[model samples]
Target: MIKKLAIDDLRPGMEVVQMSSSLWEHLPNLYTQPGPIKSEAHLKLMREQGYQHAFVEVEVPGEPLEKRLDAILADRMKDAPIKERVPFDKEIEVADRAYKSAMNHAHRLINDAKMGRKVDFEGTVETVDGIVNSAVRNPDTLLCLSKLAQYDDYTYGHCINVSAIAVVFGEFLGLSRDELTRLGVAGMMHDLGKTAVPERIINKRARLSSAEFEEIKRHPQYGYDILKRQGDVPEDVLEAVRDHHEKFNGKGYPANRHRSDTSALARIISLADVYDALTSDRSYKDAILPNKALAIMYGMRDQAFDPLEVQLFIKCLGIFPSGSLVKLSTGFYGVVYESNPNLPLMPKIKIILDQDLRPIPSELVDLAARQAVGDENLEILECADPTDYRINLKPYLTRTR
Candidate 1:
């Protein structure tokens, strides 16, 4: 049987396949070079090398891939039909409040850093903890808030979104709450050094002069310095705060640490920071479609991000992420309000545009359920930028209890 085996769980004789997800179980037999794990020594070597998990053909019998996640994450995965897992509607209100609070805190911290006021690392604990709890309860709700809730200031909003994304991705990776908290804090503070950079260069719409760009490159060190002055923060969080910009290829700034040298939390935050930055609307550019951003990141793997981490991140968020405007096979336009991580290609999109691509009343369609019922005609044809259609996903994302 094909199974998703964590590095620690890999035993001798299991053939490792390069498939996605720790949402693992029995998947299709994909022979990505048919390398069965050799022995206990090899497994130890793999773990020592920082391998997370592997898709492998093993002797153990297991549930099908699609069936396993629903059972394991019944209380955690987005929209798993389990009653104990609070519905997204009930959870989203609390999530929205948490997001706003985190943004407000981010704004204050960044401004304090600018004014040379000492940062109270303790101040961030509550907000980060709230986000982690929500992620543990309903990751999709926290992610939707990240997707839809935009603060007036980009700097603050970006910080909070990165934090939220990191928490959700960390949960998918099976990180403990304490580990997620540190990762979330790292994501929130990663760009605090940008506060030191002159506002003109940071917000410039035109190409930056080489000297100006060099100054921009120093933000990592500047961030490290700012956080170092304020003691009591965890060392790992501080390291991630400084190294989130480091490239997987050892080409990134400050320390220029190789991918293997970087902490896992930093790597997780790096993926979140880049994805949020790419998909976000900025003074420098318009937001790219989620699909486009994912495609770009996929190509940059090993060069920009850890190759396996990138693949897993893409798997967790899905090809068409929540809040994405998408098109269906029936010639309708919709916003993806929720993603199915196990089957990322399918999501529950709220249809709001008709066959003629004109505005229509909202109608939510769960593509997975439709497909499960053999409704082959209903499927996502493509993902699009919501800005292109002037579609506001907020209204469609809410549902009456």
Candidate 2:
């Protein structure tokens, strides 16, 4: 039933199989592989953009798209042997500097947007590139810094962290250096549309009313429009801003798009954005521990995120993600210092409290080397909240070994 039809003949509910058949030569990336036209709004966008016609699949439905999406996810989730080229202890200092520079750049992007100054959409190249280099060398160092440095400036902090987390995850996915850098830039710019929202709404400490919620949902489109006007923003970055909240089930905001309509980078950033938001402190709610956050996200798989993406994200960050505190099966308390990607459960731990649960000088121990060292085998029994133990992890995470 696939047939070429003039754009006027197409209507809501028709499935656009492909643009390659005719017209749509310069369509946006998201429209390249159009799905069911969900609304008149979608048709409006298509018609306004001069889409002359589309190859629509009429009446006949099949499982091919679903099977294709599964295959794409399978290819992406292949594990790469990502080694720490530079030791965490040695790279922490360098990562700290890069983290700071990126934070400053995030602030600059916001300030320029608010002040009506011309933003250098291309300027993010160097800022995110710095993070890409550090994360590739030792991913844990940047991740550790992101967790420990939860600043009062939650918006900017969030932007930089999402970028950093995305870079770390991109590296684990074995993306090329260029792709990682662009993903970083996308993360940094993902929330730029919030600048158009009122400060009161963005920082409100209470639940947003239904009216306010609707306004907030406009942020993705707002961000996309803002960047589109800037003229040089990459398509990947624009897609991330506009589609990061989109769910696999087509219930998410801005476009109600499913996984098939979204770019892979947007899907990846969506995971990073939610992970950081779940684990980082915000004015509206206390932050959940990393392990608990991962568990919650894992529970939401298929409903909100891709199941394979969640599984691999957990593998990349580890069960006991870096910079989170945990209690060992040995009855001692420690901070997870770095993830062993191959062995997710057995990470490098730094014991900060004695078995008695009393404060002690920190000792670094590799869980993977337990048998060789002749020490008692240890496993993380549970994740502990930092508030519960009154621990500040910054000093422990940054100290050079």
> lDDT (CA) for every model shown?
0.76, 0.80
Write candidate 1's Cα lDDT for 166-262 as tens digits.
Answer: 9998888666556777788888889999989998999888899999999999898788888887655657778888888899999997778888787
Q: Which pairs clash inside model 1?
A: none
Query: All candidates' TM-scores?
Result: 0.77, 0.79
- Name the 10 consecutive residues with the lowest summed lDDT in model 2: 20-29
Best by lDDT: 2
Model 1 CA deviation exceeding 4 Å by range? 1-84, 357-361
lDDT string, candidate 2, 116-224, tens digits: 6656554566678789889888999878888998575988899999999988987877676666767888899999889899888887878899999999999999899
Candidate 1 accuracy as TM-score: 0.77
